[model samples]
Target: MITGLRYLNHSDALFTGKVPHQLGSLTNLQYLDLSWHYNRPPYRNVDNIDWLSNLSSLQYLDMSGINLTKVDIFNAITKLSSLSVLHLSNCNLKSIPVVLPYVNLTYLSTIDISENDVSSMIPNWLLGMHNLVSYNGISTDISKLIRDLSGCARYSLQRLKFHNNLLHGKLPDGLAMFSNLTELHAYNNFLSGCIPESIGSLSSSLMYLYLANNRLEDPIPEAVGELSELVVLDLSFNPLGGLISNSHFAKMTKLEAIFLSSSSVTVNMSSDWTPHFQLKNIRMGSCVLGPEFPTWLKAQRNKCLMQAFQLLYLTGFGTYLLKLST
Candidate 1:
């Protein structure tokens, strides 16, 4: 009969031992956070979380850093149809649940399962989450994960990060299907293939894009110029080649930082072409920027005013102002 409870957070407290099963009595609980701030000894881990199945009204649950290595986590949380946010990062989970399509997860929006032992291909049910907005699945095989995302809820997705994973194969053209996506972070993986031209489809909303340390090749797509809202872009340490001129950055008026180091690409902007945006940091190590110091940089001296420049082996590039004007 007790159904009025709402908030509960035991995070960072030095509480020890298994979570009490009696907590299931809070049938009306909406938010529950029993996450430990730091890792506890194996013997002190919560032996089970099956009690969570009884919290049918639960909307948010965070059990991060609480060792659930042996628990059947999916079975415990799948019934939480009201859940909107779930955080289980660093929980030592060995695998993600293979939820059936019949399961209800319509209201789920954010899911953070980073720093776990999830080695299998991402479950299919995850891609069908129509309301999903942000997803963080580091160190997993993300090749299939990206492909499946194109099936449904593509419009609701915003931030998608799968850094340091076993992701291989080309950056799928299907990624452009996510019109609402703002941040795309898939760095430090085995991903290969050229940056797809369809990426221009996200020109209206995308802001942060990080595809560094991969095996990507071919010329930078000229369609990138359509992304006028881009603030940060990193394509460094890949095998990308060909000339990247001012046309590629023509409409990126919001660009603040750029990294293009250790690649075969060349930045060949016209000497007098004035950039529309003001960049705070620019890294172009091992990149060919000049036969003559491009006069365009001189425009930055008066307008954008660089704060940090990491240029190596460039004959004409030199330091400028220490900070950008506000």
Candidate 2:
């Protein structure tokens, strides 16, 4: 009898029938992962997870892709005071409990409830997770979620993934509050309006910013250049206008990939102005690049994706004449 066992990983098993409740006897278990895939599963189902409360010492749990429709999730895991990381993605969860009577896991930091149908507001208890750093809840009221997160996880939260959620409306202006935030992905949504100017405030840490395939309009804010650590910037498929000046890339020294394809913005930089970053992939199709192709591109000798720059005006359909030095 391994009563002292502290870690168990039974992920991706084709186990059928009900989830074994006897696992609760492992009171000292600090890590458990019974997650499986939705397509390859014989499908393990858990009608109730009341026994999870017994694993008071549990620090990490990942039950993603399990059938947990009948579980009282909020109440079952609330008492796990030592639990820190939880993943419940694609669990067939219908709703997130709007209110939790009490929250005991003060040290909990990372949680993923993505790909669920819990189309509700960000729960109050979730916003109160004082130490929460990484949250991946599925789309909800975008405005409300940002507002609440700005106040609660302002200093702690870092990565936010709300992409492909059909989220609408403008990104609220208070984003600067997440001082520690590094990656922000809200692409493939229905978000409109200009990127907020306050985004410059994350200059110290912000790295990857993806807002592609949205209806966002207006000029790309110069504040975006303030993200000194930024690597990938994708704003493709939007109807953005105005001159894309050299100031936009003045401080993006670490930038590698940039996608501006199908956008309406004109590259109005001085012909002699060289970019600060060495871009590897550049997609500027259908954008106004030049009467004479910008000579600065010659500086990116290591760029490998020059074919992606099928500047329609300069090179007629499929004519990739200028190649990087490699």
Give each model's clash number: 0, 0
Each candidate structure's TM-score, on Cα atoms with residue i matched to residue i, is: 0.84, 0.90
- Score residue 90 of candidate 2 by CA lDDT: 88
In candidate 2, what are the lDDT values of residues 1-326, reduced to their tens digit? 69899999989876887889989999999999999866764888898787899999999999988889988887888999998999998889999987888788798899999889887578878877889889888764688878888777899999988887888899888778899999998888999999999999999899889999999998789998788999988999888888788888878889998888788888788777888888788887777776655666656767357543535445332232434321
Cα error, candidate 2, residue 202 (Å):
1.1
Instruction: Give residue 149's lDDT in candidate 1 (0 to 100).
Output: 71
After superposition, the stretches of candidate 2 with alpha carbons farther than 4 Å from their true spots are: 38-40, 306-326
Local distance difference test scores for all models: 0.79, 0.84
What TM-score does prediction 1 earn? 0.84
User: In angstroms, what RMSD does candidate 2 have relative to the true structure?
Assistant: 2.8
